[model samples]
Target chain A: MAELDEIIHQPLRLRIMAALHALPASTGLEFARLKKLTGATDGNLGAHIETLARAGYVAVDKAFVGKKPQTTVTATAAGRGAFARHVATLQEIIAGKQP
Target chain B: MIDSQQASAALNDINDVVHRVRQSRIYQNASLIIVMWGALVFVGYLANYTWPPQGYTIWAVVDLIGIAGSIAIAAFSGIGPGAGAYALRLLVAFLLFIAFGIFCSAVLGHFGPRQMLVFWPLFTMLFYALAGLWFGYAFIVIALCSSALIVTAYFYAGPALLLWMAVVHGGALILGGLWMRRI
Candidate 1:
């Protein structure tokens, strides 16, 4: 039986992961756009993103865009694999194949 | 381990976020196209107003430019290998739309200049409203508001109909495109 990923099981992190995964591969979303998509506050989102980053599930890139600091987040390959398994596990549980 | 209910809820959350992301992407891409067309329409109407006898030439040029720009935007915005095909399909659809409009206004109805002025904007808005049924509410709202304004101008503006269209029709699209980005 497969288990849910503890790192992504958190609600805000799940939302963040979902948003990033929805984009085309290698395409990252800006920090502001991620926050808007997840509806998370700055400090809260920053903390959750740090957790995912530490788990090697996401990559964060900081750069300057036209004199403004910009941060983008993308799901790593491992992250995508984990997310897919997590979703599958969730479906299995819902289908009564797992506890 | 979570129960089935909790798992279901979690999946629902993921689905919700995915839907929002898809809609957000669509809004982002569509806003740029809408703004470009809005600017072009604004200029086209102003040129038509200034040069009454050159109206046909002005509109033909505007339509050509707007279609080209729209296709370019779609091509650049699209992802992966399907972009070219998507752009081709869009071009075909646009041509078909224009062809139908010409058939109605010029061949069958023989609308005068004033009727032609109102007809095209209203007709385009009808498509926008229909697109909203599949895309989102923003298109519908923009279409309805712009159509209402165009109809109002048609009945009331009398002598300055082109100027009124330049302001309301063009102005609404610009404003709506900006607003769509915010949403």
Candidate 2:
């Protein structure tokens, strides 16, 4: 059985990855919107996002929409691949296909 | 340390996230756009009957108004990145459909504005179906009903056809928007 990805194993990060993966490739969600979806506090969400970014699992892009600084997060191709593998591993375990 | 129980929990977590995202109002902006255009078309058809001699002029004004309104709504539709990209693609598809319709009409020459009315609803139905499929299943029902209305309009022409289009196409969009909002 494939091992779980440590980067995506945390509950909050897992939810974040799941939401991003649901979208089409190269597409992203705004930071505020993501916070609403994940129900995570700003500091908590930012920390997990930072960890994922460091692991090359997600890409964070910051820009100014007018004068307000807006941050958008997209799952990298590597992140998507890792998430897929992680999900598959979970499924395998759930199905009792892995000992 | 992650056993089957943990695995099951993770799967549920993933499912919850996907469900929430799908259920979110990411396409609210596009939905409102549809409602706006539908209203314009409805009012335009009503005006066509109300002023029979100026049918052509009424339609021209309606088209111009529609173009302007669409530009305004599109500018204000504050959508997130992913949903915004999808909406942009839909816009491209809509423009392409209009171009194709115009080309075909020019080439065919024999097909009059009445026939184009029928074609318009069919195209609109197709677009609604695709959009509904992407956003939610409610739109699929709207698409199927619009198809029925399209068939009805095709068989009956003149004032009666316009009325039918107005009632069905316009009604679907208005009602669909309300329904989405309620959800």
Best by DockQ: 1
- Candidate 2 stretches with Cα past 4 Å from truth are A1-99, B1-5, B67-75, B81-91, B154-158
Residue pairs with colliding backbones in model 1 are none
Task: Residues A1-99, candidate 1: write the lDDT tens digits.
Answer: 898899999999999999989988888889998999999999999999999999999999999999999999999999999999999999999999996
Tell me the deviation in Å of residue B165 in model 1: 1.3
lDDT of each: 0.93, 0.79
RMSD of each: 1.3, 7.7
lDDT of 2 at B147: 84
- Looking at model 1 chain B, which ten-residue stretch has the lowest summed lDDT? B77-86
Native-to-model Cα distance after best TM-score fit, residue B146 in candidate 1, in Å: 0.6
lDDT of 2 by residue, A1-99 (tens): 488899899999999999999877887988988898888999999999999999999999999999999999999999999999999999999888887
Please name the candidate that would achieve the greatest lDDT relative to the true structure. 1
